[model samples]
Target chain A: MTLLKNIWEWDKRNFERLRRFQLPHRFKQIGFALFLVAFLALLAFRFVNNDATVIKTSLKYILLIGLLIISVSKEKIEDERIVQLRQQSYQVAFVVGVLYSILILPLVNYMADVIFKKESLGFEVNSWEVLFIMLLMQWFIFRMMRKKCS
Target chain B: MKNTLKVERAILNLTQDELAKEIGVSRQTINSIETNRYVPSTVLALKLSELFKKPVNDFFTLEEND
Candidate 1:
């Protein structure tokens, strides 16, 4: 039992140490700005060139890359409080995303029924949109929690 | 949980930045602790205790609700 406790303590310490190698706060800030600009530019281009298949194909990738950079960005102080907030954010994102998806099932069905005026409109929710929503939600929640916690 | 971090820092004549640098954390972390907005981890609490030359309990105390 003592040996097991010691091993657990050692592992916990190692895990905490590993959390310190996050991107520098300034780098994260710059990345956030750059990615936001790139994403918005791509989005505007897609709007202007609505029929461009290449734009349509690349939009999701751009959004994903932007979201990834934003999510990985560290706060000004990457302390234990911020780490706790990050964990909370991921948990909140997953649970809320699943619930939101479930709720959207009926929403899509209703939209198909009313708007399309067809028995089976065959509407599909874009998987990329779901992922984007999840990441956005996590980032928002993490920011709020970090502010509240710290 | 509540802490006497501000008082302890005063006793040692250490600024928040200095204490934070000594412990390898940002100054905002020390400010948060001083303001009772954030709780330090066990490792951090121990480090603070070591720096202050006192027991951890001397700086931090559990409230009734805790």
Candidate 2:
């Protein structure tokens, strides 16, 4: 129980003025953990079935969104170290995502033209990877703006 | 912004929590204002002055540069 409480406290974080977000955070975390376990299970049984691949892809997105929601609840963080870590981690994610997207465009082209010699196939830019990039970018921008304004 | 909040609260013998509950804000907000970490909005400033039975200017000041 003490260990579990420690994890929950870390995840929910401290609110500067109020602890209003704690209840919703606990529920979000439960859902997030469930999604993560299912996602990992799907990964473990990858060779079991073809349908599992499709299910995994979709579940990946749902898991990403759930984690994003839990991570971005605006709980009014007060600890300076946590704030700095969050700011830097988000910046790194955003930079990597943008670089990956830029590289993917050219890399995918090269793969279709020179490497695989297959017909060009466009993918859904709204896929989980793209959504992850966007969420990271959002976090970076939010933290930067918060730092500048308040 | 300049404020005489600590002075007024001291006169009224109101603890930060009591003042916060009376003003519908959290104790942290009161603490922030008292420590000059944050400035309250106009409505909140007025409410606090009214609660202390003082003129708004008694609690707030407008610097010439502000």
DockQ, per model, reads 0.46, 0.04
Q: TM per model?
A: 0.76, 0.48
TM-score (0 to 1) for chain A, all models? 0.71, 0.51
Colliding residue pairs in candidate 1: none
lDDT of 2: 0.66
Write model 1 residue lDDT over B1-66, tens digit each, in one string: 989999999999999999999998878788889998888899999999899999999989999999
Please give the C-alpha DockQ score of model 1: 0.46
Candidate 2 chain A weakest ten by summed lDDT? A74-83
lDDT by residue (A11-126, candidate 1, tens digit) is 99999988655666666666567557767777687668467767656765766776777787787767776777788899999887776676775578778789878786344566
lDDT of candidate 1 at residue A109, scale 0 to 100:
76
Off by over 4 Å in 1: A1-34, A108-112, A115-124
- How many clashing residue pairs, candidate 2? 0
Candidate of highest DockQ: 1
The prediction achieving the highest lDDT against the true structure is 1
